[model samples]
Target: MANYKPDLSCQNKFISVNFSEQIQLGTFEYALYYIVENKLDLSGSYAWYDKTGAVTYPPSGMLKIILLGYAHGLISSRRIARLTKQVFTL
Candidate 1:
């Protein structure tokens, strides 16, 4: 295993977010955007693909929050859901 985990440090009080002309947002939201933009492996997510038979894009808004939490190394499902609600809304 590598000696360090790079993602955990992302949860601290500060982080830098730079938006190009195509996108404009703060760090957390931007992080979510990044996570979504870099799509998940369709093969690995078997339940969604095989069991659900849902051959479509994952829920963008919800997935964005979950992905952002993961980017910050927050693995707790509840926390991810909570932050999703708190930070991003329709």
Candidate 2:
């Protein structure tokens, strides 16, 4: 099983969003998230990291973010970063 970042959706944060509710079924984001989480074979990605040092974000999560940015035509890394901040910000 892959180690994933903690799911903090229910935490009382400054900006809270129930992603499952926000992303409706049959949508592109929904499909992307589902496919990456369930269908992809990410075992190879785990080989790159040893059980030491700082824990990095999962490949599946990174892939989802990048693909979503590309789908929205945000090619620049800076733009994508900004977009993500805006998205999670209040």
Candidate 3:
């Protein structure tokens, strides 16, 4: 076997930033991408920021969570919310 690795082995090499991928899931992923890019407010924009004080992922956190919900078929935001809690509770 060759003692080498593929070009995509780098951490940032896998994502395509073209914004033109025609896949069905592209819209969902792109939505989250732009939300973070522009630093736009998210669903919990009205919430008070706890200790860290930066709106606590106030940009694409919800979008990212919702996208993960869609990817894993978590139809309810309540369920997705639970996932977020569980993840951090680890």
Top TM-score prediction, candidate number: 2
Question: In model 3, where is the ten-residue run with the lowest total lDDT?
Answer: 1-10
Residue 45 lDDT in candidate 3: 46
TM-score of each: 0.36, 0.78, 0.40
C-alpha lDDT values of all predictions = 0.51, 0.78, 0.53
Better-scoring candidate (TM-score), 2 or 3: 2
Can you write out model 3's per-residue Cα lDDT over 1-90, one digit (the tens) per residue? 122223221233345432234323557566556555476654354344344432244324455667768788999988988987886444
- Model 2 regions lying over 4 Å from their true place: 1-4, 9-14
**Overall local distance difference test of candidate 3:** 0.53
lDDT of 3 at 37: 46
- Candidate 3 TM-score over all chains jointly: 0.40
Clashing pairs in 3: none
* Model 2 agreement with the true structure over 1-90: per-residue lDDT tens digits: 444566554565555666666878999999998998899898898677675666567777788889999999989988998888887775
Candidate 3: stretches off by over 4 Å: 1-57
Poorest stretch of ten by lDDT in candidate 2: 1-10
